[model samples]
Target: MIYTEENIEAFNEQARLKFPENKKFFDRLKNKKIKKLDEAFHPVHEEVFDEVDCLKCGNCCKTTSPIFTDIDIDRIAKHLRIRPAQLVKEHLHLDSDHDYVLNVTPCTFLGSDNYCSIYDVRPKACREYPHTDRKNIAGILPLTLENTKVCPAVFEIVEQLKKAGLGNKGGIVE
Candidate 1:
């Protein structure tokens, strides 16, 4: 199903309910003898994104901040014709993790139409938001779990993984 703002609230609510089960599944996998969980996710990730378009729902940008690296700050500052320090002063703050994150949500560079004003120079983290299809998937399962509620594609990917019996015996469940 298409996930637009009108339906995303309900979708996220459902995701919230599933968090426990999802967490359990990942935790179990963490303790298991699984191999190539990340590789297993590749096709499912592609399939999910094929149907779920980010342009239709920029909830990630609206609800969460991406980690901006030093390079990201420099590039974005240059793009805006501002000094890096000034950009940091205006738009960023160090989070609890000591990473530079946007000071506000619904990101300042996000357009009304859900396009990024700094798409070309967006943060490395922004470019890799949701990070599902990346290699070494097992290492980032925790991060993936957090992203499920934020990105519809991530939510669907987890559901698909569960259905595939990810936590089942014999490597991956499926």
Candidate 2:
């Protein structure tokens, strides 16, 4: 992956949040690729990983809106002390693809520093922002791929994978 040491470590730390099924994809890769990924999966080198912080790179928060489930709407609305419909009317739009998404660019809920204004009640998608670590990799591989440019971590990880000979998995771009 192309991630700097810092973001790669952050992605490793958060990898557990991904769906377990996402792991199955590894089974089909060349062992060299798997070994490299395994190495990458190891706990981040403290200094290398810690040096890069999301505060410095809020690309993900600034560029994309997480898909909001109904439960997410209810939770975020209750947290904001507004009706879900009202929240939707004021801030969200039902995406034509059948998902709920924020209506504005940079996200209306994103703070200036790219912190989520609704951190505690951010949507499930936000909570699981990079689906790369997902268990359902088969289903979400496309989503993860789509999110690459918007997430430096995913970008780095895929770049690393390509270097490890997993380019067949679509980890590298032309």
Candidate 3:
């Protein structure tokens, strides 16, 4: 589905309804063989994104903060023609985890149309938001589990994984 404002709410509701089953499948991973699935995950991620357009949803931008590395701070500051410290002072705060994060939601850089104001020099974490295509895919299942609520693409990817027989009653080893 090409998610939009009108239908995304319903779609998110469905994703939420299915969250527990998805969580259970991930919970079993502690003992299940995970390494082999990394090879399976990338192509699945690519395939889901071929149909899911993030610009239409942008729920990640609306809902969460990306960790801002020092490099992200400096690069975005330069792009905005401000000092890094000033940018940090104006827009960011150190979270409980001691990571720099945007002070506001619906991010300051997020345009009304869901484009990023500083797209060319956005934070590295922003660039890697949702992290579906990262290496060691199984190690990040916890992160992916959290993201399924916020990203339709991630939700779709996990559903695809299940359909591809990651952990059916027959089990993954088969």
List the global CA lDDT of all models.
Answer: 0.87, 0.61, 0.84
- Estimate the overall C-alpha local distance difference test score of candidate 2: 0.61
Summarize candidate 2's per-residue lDDT along 25-95 as a digit string, tens digits. Answer: 34344332433433442222222334446666676766677788999999999999999999999988889
Of 2 and 3, the candidate ahead on TM-score is: 3
TM-score versus the correct structure, for each prediction:
0.95, 0.67, 0.93
Error of 3 at 172 (Å): 5.7
| Candidate order by decreasing lDDT | 1, 3, 2
How much is 136 displaced in model 2, in angstroms? 3.7
lDDT of 1 at 100: 98
User: How many residue pairs clash per model?
Assistant: 1, 15, 0
lDDT comparison, 1 vs 2, better candidate = 1
Residue 52, model 1: Cα distance from true site in angstroms: 1.1
List clashing residue pairs in candidate 3: none
TM-score of 1: 0.95
Q: Would you give me the overall lDDT of model 3?
A: 0.84
